[model samples]
Structures are given as structure tokens and as C-alpha cells.
Target: MVKQMEERHSIWLRIFHWTNMIAITLLVLTGFYIHAPESFRLFSNMDTPRMLHFAMAYVLVFGVIGRVYYAIVAKDAKNVLFNPIPDIKNLPSMMKYYLFLSDSHPDYGKYNPGQKMMYTGWLVMAICMIITGFILYNPNLFMGLGGSLGGLIAVRVIHYIINWLFVLSVLAHVYLDVSEGIPVLLSMFTGKIPKGFHDSAHTHDKSIGA
Candidate 1:
């Protein structure tokens, strides 16, 4: 039987998701240019790359802030934040479902435990990227701790290390989207999903009901 899906994503959610796609792509492009070897310079001057990188950072930060705020204010946002379902208790089973070993796992209402885990991981990583980013932004502060400290140089190393983590997360995020998020995105863009998809993704049918 064809299952009619409940509309889970609203207009604002779709907008934010796509907005992030643009901003993040630009940020990554400029960021790589800035961090890449000088011999492989993409720009005639460092000024353009630096400015664009910073500008994209600012936009990304605002998006992150908005996401957090929405988590507190929006019901769907709770799926990622509060995540009432999916704890250590259910992780094993959910993993099986993802691997296709099981026909199904527990039904999710907003987000599955697996989805919540990824969301929570990214939220925290984004925040850390912001904070550690500032630390590198001002290395003199680290020097105050001790003159022997490499100061900003040390901070640069730390920042550089974290940057890779964020990069890896993005790669993983892309892969997951290709797997499950693709279907979700299609649903968001079209405002519909396979009815069975809705039943499996969310816990309560009533919440998704039109």
C-alpha cells in the first residue's frame, strides 16, 4: 500500500536548510583557499579570500545561532535537541536497522535516535569550532598564561586540528544525506513522503497528520 506522508518540514525549515547549503559551500571554498599552500594560490591577493572566508563565517555563525534558538522555540527542533527517544538503550537496535539486519526498529516521532545523535554531534562541534576559533583569533591571551607558550602559534595548531574535524563531519554529513537525508530532503522540498516513510521516521502519526 502507498503510504501518504505527513508534512514534517515547514517553509522556514526548508529555507534554513538550503541557506546553509549555499553558505557552507562558499565557506568551504574560501576556507580551503586560505588554508591551502601558498604555492597553489587561487587568488591574486590574500585579501579577497580572507574577506570572503570571514564573511561566510559570520553568516554561518548566525545560522548556527538561529538553529539553536529554533530548537528551543519550535516543536520539530525538539527532535534534534531534547530527543526524548533514542538513548544508549536503543542504539544497538537502531544500528541494526541502519545495517538492514532488522525489518524495523522502534518507530520515531520526530527524529530517530540515530538522527538525534548526528544532530547533537554537529551542534556541539559547530559550537566548539566557534569558541576555539576565537581562541586562535587572539593568541596573545594564550601567551598571558605563560610566555613559554607558543601563544597564537599554539592556538593556530589547535584551530587547524579542529578544522579538520569539522571537515570530516561535513563529509560524513554529506554521505548520510545521500543515504537517508536525501529522502527527507525530497520530502521537505516536495512537502510529501511515502506514507510508510512517515510511519517509520516518526513516533506519533497524529503529530504529522494533516
Candidate 2:
């Protein structure tokens, strides 16, 4: 069979994707260590992890900004951002397909409804994390914000909870991508996929459904 390829991710997107991935990974690790030094002895000293965590935080900040800018400039927001009415309507079909109760679902553009929801949620979560994080990092600077949110301790708790969400969601994201196939997983890195891969998969599923 002849293999044809198509662009699935742009160069700028791939850069942002990897940048965010690395920053998030480091942030999680360093975050855990910072949260419980005794429990998570990933690092021997607090200074190292604390410094690394703060550094990665800035990297993630820039990464998110760059990604959003690119999305708007490239008109790729529609491909990933969730549109409530239609996406909500399509969720049942997506859920059924994932549950193995159905073999095929109506096309959901670049991302399925669940994926769109998750990606959109991540964006929201990231923004929340940045806000809470800064409030904690510089309690003096964001004193008023922290006081409104119930102090630095509360902000810390919120940031920690969001970090856990990021960890769990990232695991789910990786699993779902790999489950789609190696091509789907590699597409992020290679920025290309076999042409008609998604279409062919859906067509086969439709045949099975029929």
C-alpha cells in the first residue's frame, strides 16, 4: 500500500507543544518535591527543586502565551476550542464510541468533543495555575488577591490541586493519543501523519457499524 502524508501540526505548534510538555513535566516533578520534601525525595536539596520549579513556571507561562497567539494567528483555535452546543450534542456519540457501545461516530473536525473539552479545560487550568502560583510565589505582591482568595495557604492548596489535575489529564491525553495508534502519537513530533488515516479509520468503523 502506498503511504501518503499530510501536515497535522505546524512547526510553531510542534515547538510550543514540546516546550509546554517539558515545562509541565519538570514543574510537576519539582512541585511534588517542593510540596513534600521528605515524601518526594526526587532532589536531595530544596533549593534545587524550588529554583527549577520557578524556572519551569516561567517557561510554561511563555509557552501558553505563544500557543494562544499562534492559534489565533493561524486560525487553529476552531480546531481545538470547544463549541458548547455542537460539542455537547456530539459528546454522546464520542462517549459511546469510546465505551465500545458504538463502532463509529460523526466526524468532529480536528478533535473529538471530549478532546476539545479537555484541551479547553487545560487552558483554563493553566491560567488558574499561573494566577494562584504567582500569588503564592510573591504573597507580598499579590497580597490583596491572596487575601480575597482566603490567604496564601488557600492559594497553595488550589495550585496543588490544579497540579494534580494536570498530572492526571496529561496521563489520559498520552494514553488516548497512543491508543489511536503510533501515527497519532508521532504526529506531534513529526508534524505529519499518513493521509486519510483518520478518514480510513472512521470509514472502517462505519462499515462495522453498518
Estimated TM-score per prediction? 0.76, 0.95
Per-residue lDDT of candidate 2, residues 1-210 (tens digit): 667789999999999999999999999999999899999989999999989989999999999999999999999999889999999999898888888887777888889999999999999999999999899889999999999999888899999999999999999999988778788888998999888788755643523321
Worst 10 residues of 2 by lDDT: 201-210
Global lDDT of each model?
Answer: 0.65, 0.89
Top-scoring candidate (TM-score)? 2
Off by over 4 Å in 1: 1-5, 39-44, 82-86, 138-150, 200-210
lDDT of 1: 0.65
